[model samples]
Target: MEKAKVYYTDMHTTFRENLLQKIQRLMKSAGIETIDFDKKYVAIKIHFGEPGNLAYLRPNYAKAVADVIKSLGGRPFLTDCNTLYVGRRKNALDHIDAAYENGYSPFSTGCHVIIADGLKGTDEAYVPVPDGEYVKEAKIGRAIMDADIVISLNHFKGHEATGFGGAIKNLGMGCGSRAGKMEMHNAGKPYVKESKCIGCGSCIRNCAHSAITITDKKASINTDKCLGCGRCVGVCPVDAIKTLNDESNDILNCKMAEYTAAVIRNRPNFHISLVIDVSPYCDCHAENDTPIVPDVGMFASFDPVALDRACADAVNNQPVTPGSRLDISEHIHGDHFCDSHPETNWKTQLSHAEKLGLGTQEYELIKI
Candidate 1:
């Protein structure tokens, strides 16, 4: 495979050009204008930070990207799917509220915000993954699947499960509908939380597979019949249905890669990752700890895998921040992400993505 081109620009800004302008310049220099954006629905996938977590990307960056798309005559919208976990972003209504709360309103980003999944996170499109070993079909949010073009605007950071969240993480796990997320994070089926179940019958009624039943004023899942579609989890009024999250970290990485392939396959896609505020955990958390390293820079590429590899390399090359998580931890592995989250190997995502022919990990970084 040939080395992909990953364009980069440092955080340093001149008096005349601010970060926003720099981002626009970076995108244009990286050939963003080459795409036929004229009159197309472009989904700019991003993580609207969990209300209290301050590590997610700002709306300014999104606006820059949106403005670029608009310049090319495209219709752009900021988007993200509802999260599987209990949080402000669990459902479409709540997810939009969270995005607004985190300063991602249309008024701020120069574009509207759309929760890719419909209300309750059940609206999805089953996309087939031809090269998938773990997932045959990826259940992606309907709104995301409906878009004509896809652009992943990611905040590069460490993850407890995936080692680091980058373009692949943003597109794969981030684009998954509730069921798709369940499939990626769990090796087994979901179970009813007896204590939380109020015998509401919502789960039983929503179960298309007849996998759930109510007994003794409690709900129980028949794992044999359960398909792990996660519909029960979405419909439970009381949040009683829950996934086991039993998938091993490595398998989780591989599943995420397959999900990513399902998203970008046969679609016009681009990727950009900002390696700032390098939090040690995912933005899904309500709180974020100190950054492990100094801000690296911004990166853009047509190749998601190569973009991720470049960003990971940049973060790994930087010096650790004093008093950050990495500074205090025992650095057994030389890699910063590995040292931060010892249980995870971030390379698995890139390697699996490469095997799926998403893109190569080898990249040539072009500094602007």
Candidate 2:
């Protein structure tokens, strides 16, 4: 495959052109206007940081993207699916609240914020992945699938499980509904936490597969019968049901690539990643440690895989921040993300994505 074009611009800004304007310029240079967005619903998929994590992208950046979309005759909305974990973003209501708390309100982003997966994290579209080896069908958030165009506005950073979080991470794992996330993160079915079970038959009632049963004032999940749809995890009022999270990191990356393919397949999609913050863990954590590397810059591309590769290369090229996590750790791999997260190989995601014809890892970085 030929090298894809990945446009880039550093964070350095002059008084005349602020960071927001710079991002807009970057997007334009990246050919965002090429997409015919006439009165179309465009989903700007992003991670509205966990309530207490301050590293997520700012609302101003979202506004810049949304404004560009609107100027191109599109209706844009900032969106993300509810997280599978028990956190501020576990459900739509709480997820919206978390977005709002993190300053992602419409008033700030110049667009509405939609929890893609709906109230209970159950509203989903089972998109078939024809080339998938691990996931035959990806359960994506309904709101995301309903959009006419998809845009990933990602906060590129370190990830404990995936080495780094970029366009693929933002679109694949980020777009997955609760069940889809469960599928990516778990190799096995969910189980009931006996201590948390209140004898509430909520799980039993909601289990379409009859995988759950209440006994002795406690809930138990039958692994043989469970489909791992994660509905029981959502309906359990007491949060008794929990996923095993047994999927190996490599398999998790492959599943994530398949999920991303399911998401952007046969759709007009674009990707932008800001390689700042460079946190050593996912934004799903309520707290973020200091950035492991100095702020790099912003990147945009039509090819998600190429975009991620570019961003990763940029981060790896930067010097490690003093006193940060990467500074103290042993840099055995000579790669920033791998040095930060020894357990994960981010290349698996890009290679699998390329193998599935999502996009090529080879890219031409066009600096603005």
Model 1: what TM-score?
A: 0.99
Model 1 C-alpha RMSD to native = 0.8
- Tens digits of lDDT, candidate 1, 177-214: 98889999998899888998999888888888998878
Which pairs clash inside model 1? none
Off by over 4 Å in 2: none
- Largest lDDT belongs to which candidate? 1
Clashes of 2: 0
Kindly list the per-residue Cα lDDT of model 2 for residues 38-154, writing each as its tens digit.
999999999999988989898999999999999999999999998888889989999999999999998988899999989988899999998899999999999999999999999
**lDDT for each candidate structure:** 0.93, 0.92
State the displacement of the C-alpha of residue 193, model 1, in Å, after optimal TM-score superposition: 0.5
Q: Judge candidate 2 at residue 362 and give its lDDT.
A: 90
